[model samples]
Target: MSGVASTRQQEVQRIVDSLSMAIAQHRLKPGMRLVEAQIVDVLSANRNHVQAALQRLALQHIVTIAPNRGAKVARPEAREAREVFIARRAIEHAILAGITIGKMALHNDEIEAHLQAEEVAAASEDRRHIIRELSQFHLLLANISDNRVLSEMFSNLMVRSSLIVALYQRNDTPDCQCQEHRAVITALRAGEVARAQAIMDEHLRHIEQQLELDDAPPPPITLRDALLVSW
Candidate 1:
């Protein structure tokens, strides 16, 4: 009995992780519909477990659930974008500072593994995979920071940021902001904390500049449409 419960929990976690990664990479965008049947099909999980995962994301505000609309990724106002970036800047600044002060270093094998994954994603033709890699790069840093709370917070923010980018992205470069990752990694490897932080700031600044937020209206969809629609 306990084993069955544990397996269900694990499946729920896997669904959440996969969806979060998809969100961060812009594979899932703001205002994009999340249909339960479709999600269950894609995640290959039961409807109940998928529902559990969606509930978890809602707690982080990464997704929103309307009474009859089911759930969709969160689409923040332009003002919210600015607010999010402000918070991100503060959070990442502290993360980098902690890494510097603690002189925390990533394992060589781990770094190489991440880089290899990035390369594979970059080389792939799938836009979704590319976006996933871009988002994971930032998450990897949070993990390296070794602060559990901050890591979880960053994970949630990363999901939201991906949605924002999808709503406002100005270019189609799958490899965007990748060089900045290399720069930060290099600085960290050299024990140059100041350089690492500088690289991150520049990287984030570039992302902010790329948003094309010009007050486009949300695509027309009512509560009825979302519920009736499969995906």
Candidate 2:
């Protein structure tokens, strides 16, 4: 019975992860509707598992569920957007602090590879790909920090931030800057954790500063289009 239950939970988690990735990739815009029936059909997943997965996302504040409206990607309010950034600043600070100078092993090549991917995406002007890459850079740093707990916390925050950006970003505002990511890596490689932390703070603050945060209406996007790539 336990094994059966575990398998069921794993199935539910697969749905949860796919949806979360879609959200983090910016393919799933804020307030985009997620009809359970459509998702079950698109992914050929069990309706029960699909509902469970969305409930999980709701628990994480990544999605919102309404009695008759089903679920939609969360549309953070202006105040919630500001608070999300504040929370991220705290979480990311702790993640960076775990990388003490000369204590934790750092991997530059992996991050460099990620940066290269970001460059390729930028060259092609693939906005969605670029957004995914930018967010992954932070997740990469969290992994390198070697604090699994912090990594998990920051991962959730990254997705929430994605929603915040999608909803409130200024028209002229650009996606996360790769140069800033490179700077963070450079500071880390030089054993300057404090400098790296400062860069990260400035980087995040710049992104936050770019937000219009006026409760812009969430744009239109189909749930199938958002979750298709993930499946």
Candidate 3:
């Protein structure tokens, strides 16, 4: 019984992680419907498993499940968009305040690796991949802070931020700028904690500025396109 239950939990977690990655990557945009049959097909999971995954996501505010409409990626409101950034600024500021030269040194290798990945993704000009890489870079910084509680909090913020970006971002603006990330790293390497924190604050502000919160929402894509794993 324990073994079977554990396997079931793992399967559910697997589905949730995949969907979360797609959402964070901007491959699955806000307001996109998540058809169960399509999700089951794309993930090769059972119907029950897919449904369970969607339920978990809904609890996280990552998806919305309607009585008759089924589930769709969450569409955050304009007010919620501003609130998300405010929350992010507070959380990220705390994370940066705790950083030290020794701590930064510990994660230097991982940081460099993530930066390289970001550069490669940017060079490819694959928007989805670039978005995912950029988001992961921030998450990596949180993890480097070595505070599990803070890291988990930032993880949730990243998800909400992703949804907000999907709903409110302008077509012409880039999701993240690689040069800004590099600048933050350079500041940290020089033991200029204040400068690094300032850079991060500026970076977050730049991302939020790209959003057109007052603009009309985009038309939702077809279920097939939404669930297509390749996209």
Candidate 2 residue lDDT tens string, 84-143: 899998988888887654433446567678989988877767667778778888888788
| C-alpha TM-scores of all predictions | 0.79, 0.93, 0.88
Global lDDT of each candidate? 0.75, 0.83, 0.83
Q: After superposing candidate 1, which stretches have Cα over 4 Å from the reference?
A: 1-5, 100-106, 116-126, 215-231
Judging by lDDT, tell me the better candidate of 1 and 2.
Answer: 2
Q: Estimate candidate 2's alpha-carbon lDDT, on a 0 to 1 scale.
A: 0.83
In model 3, what are the clashing residue pairs, if there are any? none
Residue 117 lDDT in candidate 2:
90
Error of 1 at 3 (Å): 4.6
The digit string of per-residue lDDT tens for model 3 on 91-189 reads 988787777788888988888899999999888887677887898888887877778899978887898898888777786335548999999888877
Candidate 1 residue lDDT tens string, 96-213: 7666433444356776788788888777756667776777777777877788988877777777777777787776664456668888888887778788988888888888998887
**CA shift at 178, candidate 1, in angstroms?**
3.4
Off by over 4 Å in 2: 100-106, 172-176
Clash pairs detected, candidate 1: 25-131
